[model samples]
Target: MAKRPEVVPDILDWYAESARDLPWRAADRTPWGVLVSEFMLQQTPVSRVLRPWSAWLERWPAPAALAAEPAGEAIRAWGRLGYPRRALRLHAAAVAITERHGGEVPDDHEALLALPGVGAYTAAAVASFAFGRRHVVLDTNVRRVLGRVIGATAYPPNHQTATERDLAEQLVPADPARAARWAAASMELGAIVCTARNPACGRCPVADRCAWLAAGRPDNAPPRRGQSYAGTDRQCRGALLAVLRDADEPVVGERLDLAWPAAVQRERALAGLLADGLVVRVGERYALP
Candidate 1:
């Protein structure tokens, strides 16, 4: 008989014994709760997502609650989460949910994908986690796990491509409940043990079957690109949004100038925010809409 699959069982068993008892994983977590958690988890750590997620679920509890409020509340609620744009997107998604799905997070993949901020990864995650659908839920952790388990690399060359998705789907266990748990478990292993740098292979459950170990743990891949944050428009945008989010009423252009030193970049950032619908201009003042 062919070699028994190692990663799935090892990961599931490890997760069964070791997975963190997160608030979102509670028995009473609603679909809205799952949606909010997924959005918060994007490019953010689980540690960071916890408190805010709990507070958000406690405050809103449903799409209608968030949808009824101004976008500024979401931005403020986001609070140092990094990538505040996701807050705006979540707010828009809430509005969309209210209008389209009668304030319920749709269970179907296509409908979920159509939400303002719900992309493929988030859509699949909600479907699997909330509804327990059998779908290949690929995230950064899952991608890295697959990379080491099969390709002997830290991560796939360029994220989840068609080939990568096919590989992930092939690895997903047949049962829906087990498959969801396996996806979360594989991600947990990659996050805590099979980390990008200085991986703790000894602690990894699937270390016995890891191709990267078989290949002598070589770093054959190029270093990932560094992001430029200083002097970028993103900083300017953040500063502008901070001012707007704190204000009770729309801010004048002159008021926004206090946030940034560069006038031109500040103007550009405010204009971009207006175009993005994150901010609305009333005569000369800007406020979250």
Candidate 2:
């Protein structure tokens, strides 16, 4: 069995050579940049986030800048990111940062967690990656990597557990800098090599030390189900939002009616958008908010 400490150096060295040059990971990347990246990356792919992130940062470089904009502007700027509520929450977070944190993304994990959309994984990621603090930083990628390398599991649990948290804390290096690097490296390995499906074990740096590999990589019982997007209320909401996003003026109720054919579903979807604060009602029209 490979000792847990032995894994860090190999993973970090491989990361040094193979890590993707993501904009958020650049030396000059700001805490705000990291915060924005974290929010945008939620359930969205890196490839889709790149352009929108660039545009967003260019427009609102700081928390104060974004706070000055209306929530509608933030939603419009979100631009097909999906789950547009993240934009509203992010806008609220920026406003909170400007008012409470003096326009700075706080380095403290607790402070980061207090932000509107920031959660456990995001707070840890910002503290470790942006500030080089020692934190577990266990996102889906990191969880998957740790599950395979240490737990001998083909997949991590559907939700995080105390055991997983304790394991992550135990495995993370005590040295703050090394721990931060380990967080990024482990996540990168999972993202690019130890992927969810068809993992490239040959390219993994710690393949020899992986428990799952040693155990012959048995398939996960009760295979993970993929999310369905077609013809769902989510799709209806997206279509309605798309029309509003592209319009110059508040769209008529009749216009929104064209988005989804099923009257009940469309109404439910629109109501959901309104409830989510992603849309606003103006007289008989609706607009992004």
Candidate 3:
């Protein structure tokens, strides 16, 4: 068994003071709000999500309201958040909620996971934050923090195993309220202090207990590969979506043709978007459907 760090308490204590008071975390946040927040946070940064989340909650305060609207609105509402599929998936989730859960977010983890966009992280988050259940909320940030504080190296190649889950559960404070805060704190610590690149160890509350530091911070066996974004199909899709998101009406192929010049990449991008149901073609014009 790996030796656990002792400074988890200090980290959580520091997080209580430093964590951002996000709008989605307002005292009046309903289960619907929590669900929306988890969706918006996927692949999008906190600063980018703030204004949009506020606007979304203000416009559609419940799943029923969102379900009543066309899914295109959700995609347009997502703005430059990237990964527009999340918006479509969220719309489907709203519809499922209205049909299955009486327009209310499900409290049960299994029921939540059954939703279109909801997954393990989201289900556990909603369960803990909105429903006050004890569950290990593991995200990339949590995994990084746990890996450094205990293993003194990068995370393993695959997802967390049963043993890792048990260890995380053990570290969760027994008090439900505090445990929820602790989980969020661990995530925040990993995001801001114990980050993936050039971690701010000087500012970290758990530095003293970090096994990575104790082991002299040796470079791991190999460097992780970085993802390529430029000239990729994803970049072209985003460029195409940007135009659709801003257009008040459907745009013709000529207009979209102007966004990207490469014929092959442009056709591939358009086909991918069409296949993803992000855009619909009426005659020669394209628009969000």
Please provide, for model 1 over 179-266, each residue's C-alpha lDDT reduced to its tens digit, 9 standing for 90 to 100: 8887778778888888888889888887888888988988865746767989899988988888887887887878788789898898
What would the per-residue lDDT of candidate 3 be over residues 1-289, giving only the tens digit for each residue?
Answer: 4757466679778987888787767788899888888999997788888888889989999999999999999999988887899999999999999999999899888999999988899999998888887778988888778877887885543557776676787788888888788778898898888887888999988788888888887667553565798999899999999999999999988888899989999999999999988999978799998
Point to the candidate with the largest lDDT: 2
- Least accurate 10 contiguous residues by lDDT in model 2: 1-10
Off by over 4 Å in 3: 1-6, 154-163, 221-223
Identify the leading candidate in terms of TM-score. Answer: 2
Clashing pairs in 3: none
Global lDDT scores for all candidate models: 0.85, 0.91, 0.86
The stretch of ten residues in a row with the least summed lDDT in candidate 1 is 1-10
- TM-scores, one per candidate: 0.94, 0.96, 0.92
lDDT of 2 by residue, 1-289 (tens): 2347688889999999999999999989999999999999999999999999999999999999999989999999999998988999999999999999989899999999999998989999999989999998888998898888887888998889988888888889999999999999988998999999999999998899899999999877653677897989888999999999999899898888887789999999999999999999989888887
